[model samples]
Target: MSGEQAGWALELYQRSVLKQQKFAGIQSLLGDTAGKRCLDIGADNGVVSLLLRRGGGDWSSADLAPEAVASIRSLVGGRVERIDGGPTPFADREFDLVVVVDFLEHIPDDRGFAAELGRILKPGGRLIVNVPREPRWSLVWPLRHAIGLTDQWHGHLRPGYREDSLAALLKPWFEVTAARTYCKTFSELLDTALNFGYVIKKRGQGEGGSTAKGTVVTQADWQKGGAGAMKALYPAMRAWTALDGLLPFFKGYRLIVQATRGSD
Candidate 1:
């Protein structure tokens, strides 16, 4: 494929991925309980805040960074809260529902974090989670230089997990309610691409990998070869894309798990 085609393919893939990854099944499971307090970890740009508010869930947002808290507050006016220090900062049983989306892989000891999530959820409260699949698949870092996202993968300590593995972690605290694999696809020039998917897992782990943190990367001080580099990457990109189809036997794109807090 030509560089221009490769660029277009990548763009198409991104749109497909975003659509799959951002579903609000969490709100549905929360049902009419949305007006209760919600806690969304890794609230990033606070997009989920809007989702919760729209869903009729009154919730506060939490992030690991004060700067992020400030930015979110500026954007939404006192809706976001800053949690200073370490994993799992909230008091016990403080929330009705927690949502953690695509944020678990960054922490090394994910099980410990899940345990903490369980501690903070009220009895029968729900936790919604989505993370990378077991096979650890990702598009070729994608124009890293153009986007200035050097070391983008560093944030993921073990970004991939299987359904059974995830189940084992949460079984102690939550009962499995619903579980499934979900992906969204987009077609471009007769080729269909998947952007990202959720291994939809839920429970009262109160959104363990659910919160947000603050970090930044400045533009790289050097110019990327742009179209030239893409030209060179084409051969590898094609091979990688081809391999993605064949590797399902070993691991999938992600694992989805859903569980609810066990009645104590």
Candidate 2:
């Protein structure tokens, strides 16, 4: 890939197949955001925040990682903040919507943070969340462990979430209005293999203080040559990723949920 193409690859990293699935899932529930006040939390690759912003919402983003804060700001370019993992800096009932992605499972005080989510949203505000769903019975478990993508390495405080358990975590002030799973068997298989390759390439590299937020949270972790290699193979990867759509019978490996804030 040319240097320009490599830079394009870096920008497009969040456009991965799995992430596109999550974005489609979110947009299905999100509908119109033209006049809404939205906040996206978690240090996801900033792609989620970018996708939502395209809906024309007044958007802001926050993360505990300085790297993510800088990265996300470069994309969304408005009101990205670096937080310290305490109470957030926004005002009470300050937002009409909040989106959480690949993040809740990492918090040591998740319930407390759920309260914080509730505290910042207006009555009847919307919440959209995406999380890993790695139940013990999941067929993907063996490969996941084989690739060194275990919860410990990913900085997960817990393995992941089930629909019920995740609902419980958001129970304090949100009512789950919709729930579903994505990243089914074929997709999981493809994603795991891709992750293994990245892990193999990125092996032994210092985590740049990202271990606490998950080691591979962004494609930036793929770095120079890794990004170029990924850009080269990206077309085949996208084609491989498309196989998942043909088989709906397989159980998925991640969950996307839509919820609404409850009245005080």
Candidate 3:
């Protein structure tokens, strides 16, 4: 059973335009998992994991970081595993679906990670990946950098992946079906500004040891009227994101890629 404070991540989800857009893109592409065995790996804050569980899958979540595992535990109860950074403990072809979220770039051996993902998935199984997309040039790069969102801060080994490059990485085990990018300039910049404020506020208090760092909300953050204020303002934030539709020319920072595992 989830603790009383699982709303920590849910609160962050409500306040984050980027996370909302990412979740929307992922849900639209990921079909029903009812009665299927699903693995959600590498979730930092585990909001998606909680949502997936609610959506009715035989869901298990895991993370390589202990901080992440504890954070996930607060949301999804006993279903999450804390794994070492190597081949996972799951049996071969054990999962009908696998969703990899935001941890690929943090890995040094992404090829091996891809291989492991393939090994755990049954043939014809679906895989969903969410990542920060690499762009040729981003106008908001300086803003993000100024806010201390560098690769190290993000725990990223590399910046991120392009669709083609990421597809090639998964080529040995799966076929890519679809790719979509979101969080365009307007929304992304807004996200960055919010993160800047969050970082500032985080400095004022002792952070949760079980919680992963970098812009995620914690139980402590839920204690005040601030969350209510943000939830009430989220609609306006969503409306401001509508400006993204006006600039189709600029690629967004977030990317979701879907693939299917093969029997080999």
Best by lDDT: 3
TM-score of the candidate numbered 1? Answer: 0.59
The digit string of per-residue lDDT tens for model 3 on 1-264 reads: 445566567777778677778789889887988999999987776787887787798999998777677778788888788765569889999999999888788777888989999999999999999988999988887778877767666667788899999999998899999999988988987877776666566666564222332344445555544577678778988899989999987778888899999878
Number of clashing pairs per prediction, in order: 19, 0, 0
Which of the two, 1 or 3, has more lDDT?
3
Better of 1 and 2 by TM-score: 2
**How would you encode candidate 2's per-residue C-alpha lDDT over 120-238 as one tens digit per residue?**
99999999988888665867778788768787767788878888988998997999999988887778887778767666655656433335666434445555565566667777878
User: What value does the lDDT take at residue 6 in candidate 3?
Assistant: 65
Candidate 2 wrongly placed segments (more than 4 Å) = 1-15, 204-210, 216-223
Instruction: Compute each candidate's TM-score over C-alphas.
Output: 0.59, 0.87, 0.91
Q: Candidate 3: how large is its RMSD?
A: 2.4
Q: Candidate 1: which stretches are off by over 4 Å?
A: 1-21, 25-28, 65-68, 83-87, 136-154, 184-256
lDDT tens string, model 1, 125-242? 8887766655344343343213333224224556456677777777688776766553311111011111110101112323222223413110110022223443554455444444
Candidate 2 yields a Cα-based lDDT of: 0.76
What is the Cα-based lDDT of residue 118 in candidate 1? 87
- Lowest lDDT block of 10, candidate 1: 193-202
- Candidate 1 vs candidate 2: the lDDT winner is 2
Angstrom error of the Cα, residue 146, model 2: value is 2.7
Reference-based lDDT, each prediction: 0.50, 0.76, 0.80
